[model samples]
Target chain A: MIEQVADPLPQTGFAKVVLELEVNNHPGVMSHICNLFARRAFNMEGILCMPVAGGERSRIWLLVFEDQRLEQMIRQLEKLEDVLAVRRHGAEHEVFERLEDFFH
Target chain B: MMQMTGAQLIVRLLERQGVRTIAGIPGGAILPLYDALGGSELIHHVLARHEQGAGFMAQGMARASGQPAVCFASSGPGATNLVTAIADAFLDSIPMVAITGQVPLSMIGTDAFQEVDIYGITVPITKHNFLVRSVEELLTVIPDAFRIAMSGRPGPVLVDVPKDVQNQLISFTDFPPRVVSDSLPPVDAEAIEEAARLINEAEQPVLYLGGGVVHSGASALAVTLAEQACMPTTMTLMGLGAMPVDHPLSIGMLGMHGARYTNFVLEEADVLVCVGARFDDRAVGKAAQFCPRAKIVHIDVDPSELHKIKRAHVAIHADVGSALEALLPRIRKSMRKRWLSHVDSLRSRFPMQLPGMDDPRTHYGLVRAVAAALDDDAIITTDVGQHQMWVAQAYPFRRPRQWMTSGGLGTMGFGVPTAMGAALAEPDRTVVCFSGDGSLMMNVQEFATLAEENLNVKIVLMNNSSLGLVYQQQNLFYGKRVFASKYGAGPDFIKIAEGFGIGAVDLDQAANPRAALAQALQTPGPCLIHASIDREQFVYPMVPPGAANTEMIGG
Candidate 1:
């Protein structure tokens, strides 16, 4: 199956995921990252965009899908006017910090 | 250029969401939300007689049509008045979004005029709450709050947007898409496999369906499972149409007010495969002794509910539809002959049967006739008491969410307001409320709201001269002591309703009963039909607390 090959995907059952952006300085760069996430519900959680490094251009983290047209994703990000390196992490695999029983 | 204020942005968003009507009475604290409304062409605000009545009005709209209803209130007393309606929506899982304008940010901790910690108070009763502090942030949180309140497991959501933030100007482009954690608790494969095994092994399996079937839109899936497994199914009060009354596999309602056969079948089942139903105290009286003969395979969306009641032989934390869908393909086709025969025998032995119409003139007779005439499309609401039981016992509900009353927390005086909510939600449908005398008097002030709106609702009062349920308890358990149950000075209900300028009547005989009821139905606006009944009548087939199904009492 394609799911097993050349892939990494967030195991969430949701068909789509959208990442909210909160960039400070580089609106154009953040827009590019959002564009990358908008193409398809890839092998990774789906869409990802957030202000990189407190919204500064130096902190450019191109949110890319782990198995999303990866070759195409990397090529697209690398070709960006302000090109940045990329890293992949599973969305659902985060360690839960705590759960507070604060039901008032 | 500075963008519009948060209040302005909200009105436009609501318009996009098709929220044409809102119910609320504005005050000092919530003026910004009302002020923003001054220029908007989209939203129409209904000036309520009272904040509590407004809350019920919003609820009525939501229950009427499953569309999320909006309500607004100011801080302090305004917010406090909205509490019961919010709690009502919480228990019933109605899609409602309530916005409370808080005091200025500077005035918050100081308890400025009319300020209260509305968010903290509503945390338990609401699915979610937000204390929005900034205008720029409101552009994002406002739509998210509305979507959250209406999506997933729908319930009431309270958004306390502060007055200062509402008035602040902000440059806004468009609202952001909702940000939800991608993490999802996967369905345990082993648990699902074991559940499949136990279901396959049991000969006398009873599929106990609940509201989750309706919640997940799994009626078709549930029916498939029932047919494949060849098991008889029964529903809780909330689970009425999950399995239709006419289905041969469906044995109607269960528990205290359930049909005789439903209790009988449940008492004798070898395996009880429950779906999406928390074994509430009313459903499982004296939990320790409930269905002692069977193994409980509990399936609920909330994981906390598995061992919260009776121990489950196989506990599954998955959507009932998902679980059943997974298991249905693997289920075998052979029917359990002995078990089927046993359930059939029990059903035949104690089928739900009303007392034969002796005079054709009693309260029960009227209820049966009205229910028959209505033909299952009319919505029925009840105030908690003998009348509530009578309607539940007599009326045949063919649709889920058709009969909306206070189910889990049987709040008295809930009938009229809830009926108002249902009528608001479904303006086209005939909303009928069967209220007890004691319960009707709690929020009788809503009569003016009913008359003002002239909503198409049929209000039927079972005017027994006392708190009928309390009277029943006094008669049954309190050594037959005649207590504070009767009213020497009965307020003329006909005059009270007529005072509100609504069509009103009192039913006394059979020849005129049909004509009066038909006339009431034919009238264009709200009708208050009061039927005086003898206070001594008690609901039958009631299994006393801690008693088994067979130990039923009364007629």
Candidate 2:
């Protein structure tokens, strides 16, 4: 079994932003989205997902640092067939902030 | 309404998609689909020794025909084995559909025998993938798989069907209409106008072609553009045959193993028009410094590739062929005599040096000899390494779809099976696979498949008793500590070929090697022509990895 190690350098200095994704609700939709970020080595700080529009689609909120590769990552995300649309918001968004107490 | 088993539905769908041949291996989980496939009169199945070979064979068919090809495998190891080929197709943008079997849906997460979550595993490598839950999903999933595989920038798609799903019965009102590529994104007229103006006004322009030219069938238009603008053209490895290598405007392949003149020409360019080719790190060494002075005009069907590397002054999101068609009329044709002369002068000063052409014993000479024996009609495929680089440098390819090699992934064991696939698709044309000894051993078991099918494939094995590229890298970069690069002892490849019931010719032992090579290549069935190469030689004009293209070593 492989051992899990903590990240040596935390990305605290960078500014955070929220990405809102409207995706087709399915078993592998999250896998596809998460796989994109994971494979590119982009860190996701926070996430919240719930079904919307009669459960046909799901809304996912991703909190990530504002890195140079963010634009490329969004472009890659838009390329996915199931991802309907992507919206960006400032880190002050309440979606992740509302859940801060649960994490604490 | 028509009622059919899921397996039968898949076979019928594949036939409707115009797939005539499929390469695959059968296992317990996928047996039902095999049964249905066996009954089909329109589709012929080629049995490969390994799942990976089957996957590459499908890639070969897709690459040669410019159509999405299909392959099959069972769950677990069979599915795992196909990952590399799928990744290879994904990187090279080959249109392929891989269907794998899974354990029954109820037993999926229990770690049942021969069970693996292939749908999850392949998510990263495939354009899209599916794990069918019910028989009903097959109707939409099958067509979607083809559309996803071929639409936009083509890539591989995977469909994982559970054992119970294949056995389930389904009724449908009508079969889906035969699928074609999804309509291409509309060409941006404003961007095309801007690009044409840039080309019209630029003093020193270079047309850089990529695999997209071949995929979009826009090679002719690309050549026309180059000639009309008097622009010197360069191709990535995947784009080798996009312009005839001997064309006066052609600058050959550019990048890591590119000709010195080609990189220098790129360095001096005032305008760089990149079509259908992403600026891959291998193609553009140290991206920040590549084409530092040139204004970029990037045209690709995939919108994301634009501004991803070098920022494009004019980024057109549309099919390459459509964009070229739109740009052709608005562009002014000019004979930039001064720029052409400068390019020609650079060519003369830093010409690609092929050391030996008279003797068939040397590596470069052997490649040339083979080219001389065969015409431009022969489809050339290469396993990755020094031999691949040599063939890319030496072969006089004259047309698109004439050369197929694993470019992006640089998969070593790609040559033999892919050549067999090319042969399978185009039975009239002779296919030659240039392979090194190290690459050949990776999928040597495919020799049996080649003989069984009697494909007109000639494997020209360059035996150097070592991983030539690794040895070269070690010698060049690793302080000459050659560990694990050399083989303890080389196998008798001639006997190995004969053991697989294929014909063999040892060029080293031949009295007149060139004549013997010509004779062997000319003969019909499968044959392996073995020639020993010196391990000391390395691919010349190296970029030293992570360095800029202009900073080169020896030629």
Candidate 3:
């Protein structure tokens, strides 16, 4: 049975890893990334997305745990037609952390 | 430049993408698009009773031919109905293009009649979605939709076109050929060498194959790797047909409801080489405990799978076929005789035994009868239930794509329309659908479509008079308080088929169900075999929810 797990990913890890993606700005690109993780039952701790300067592309920052699959996930992200480049960051990456602080 | 309506451009682009058929039901909102489609000789539109059936039919074609299949739906309820099928396609990695008509660009979000934000609703389900605001945007969007649907772990893509856009007259300058630049990045040589080193070093290794192996067309390469390395192999449910079921080194399916021996072998494995598979929770219960001793070497086309559950000692992010091809040359040839013998002993200790294999009145017998009746080349589609699980356990699927089921979504009512889709995709080959009574009723309306089109789909209904899977789950967990699961002696499926002008055989009264099934199989054009099975019969070797694979019950 290969359906997406409705259950949220177990909340335990704190060492956050951030992946910055530059992708073609379209309705479904974000869904593709979210769905991919959802299928694997992986959780995205945080997400930040906005249109780039030309409105032709989007920049997405995905917050996740520092899991082993991170490198491979980046490789898969690079494969999408909408996704142009992916860059990684360590726990100190402020996008999600700052958002969490602001919410707090 | 030729002036044409947006609807005309959409149909023209579909023709360029080599789409010959589309499954859909026209509604008031989508009239413009349907109007354009009405005159197009390039595409044949199969009118489905429900939008969901249309979606699944497209899925069946996609799964059969490995090409992007198209489905159409109008706004609101029509678009919502297609969601389940779209989600199914996404989870299963089926390449599908679902085109839904919006009310109009101006009317969107105004709570217009039959208008819904289909693009927004489909965000989590589709690989990508588009809401075409203007006619000109379609020129690039339509072709891009096809390209996205077919490339890199193919999945469903949606295009929500408003009525205004479809009717708008626009000058079209260029219809560029759909180009998918699928240049896979170079494989990591160091990773390959490391994986080869681990393979050569491990004494008790197991080769684990997943759906990706089948998706990448690396089954032959997988077999070669297994034989050369003398590694015992086990498949995930999705990876059932990755290796021929009878291969000596093939250890059968693993995880929940997996072969008892196969799970034991996995427990004992020193090194696990997983290709084209994510270590799903169902497959590897208690992820940390699974293959604890094994140094996992995971090779897959999708990067998200590696270390998602079990951390890999070496992870290669490349297509399964290419990864295996590169690693095959680097690894040494040696037989793990002791490991093979250990696996053999495990197999002998807990061999698979389906109850009533000899009796034609039972579920196993029905499964066996259908398998025996159909030709080896027949494509089998199944709905979600006990029947589906039983089919997985008993069916001797020889190759990939031969066995198509909703693995990820576990969607019911998938069998009938998908079988029709498969039959339509490969008109020469026979298509068989194994459905339970509960699942069959979900999209029972499609039976008419099957009859009208005269599709070469033979449906074998396992009428147990209950939601067998739900009933089984209730028995296991809810203390047998069967709630809303039991459908007592439902409608006569044979009569229903006859109503649709399709041929049918009732095996309930037949003295020999196997013979009756064989007769039904040979019957021409859209037939149904109604086989009544014991409601109490349960699928065996079921691992309780969250239980380890080794802790399965009732084999």
Please report the TM-score between candidate 3 and the true structure. Answer: 0.91
lDDT of 1 by residue, A34-66 (tens): 444454444333333445565463443223334
User: Per-residue lDDT for B423-477 in model 1, tens only?
Assistant: 7667778888889889888778888888887888888888888988888877876
Please provide TM-scores, in order, for all candidate models, with all chains considered together.
Answer: 0.79, 0.97, 0.91
Residue A83 miss distance in model 2 (angstroms):
0.5
DockQ (C-alpha based) per candidate is 0.02, 0.35, 0.23
Per-residue lDDT of model 3, residues A3-56, tens digit only: 333355455765688889998886667877886678656789889999996899
User: In candidate 1, how many Å is residue B258 off?
Assistant: 2.2
Query: Which of candidates 1 and 2 is the stronger one according to TM-score?
Result: 2
The count of residue-pair clashes in candidate 2 stands at 0
Better DockQ candidate (1, 2): 2
Q: Best candidate per lDDT, number?
A: 2
Ten residues in sequence with the least summed lDDT for candidate 1 chain B: B175-184
After superposition of all CA atoms, the RMSD between model 1 and the true structure is 12.6
Q: Which stretches of candidate 1 lie over 4 Å from their true place?
A: A1-104, B177-190, B356-360, B546-551
The candidate maximizing TM-score is: 2
- lDDT of model 1 at residue B127? 69
Residues B460-482 of candidate 3: C-alpha lDDT, one tens digit per residue: 88988999989988887788888
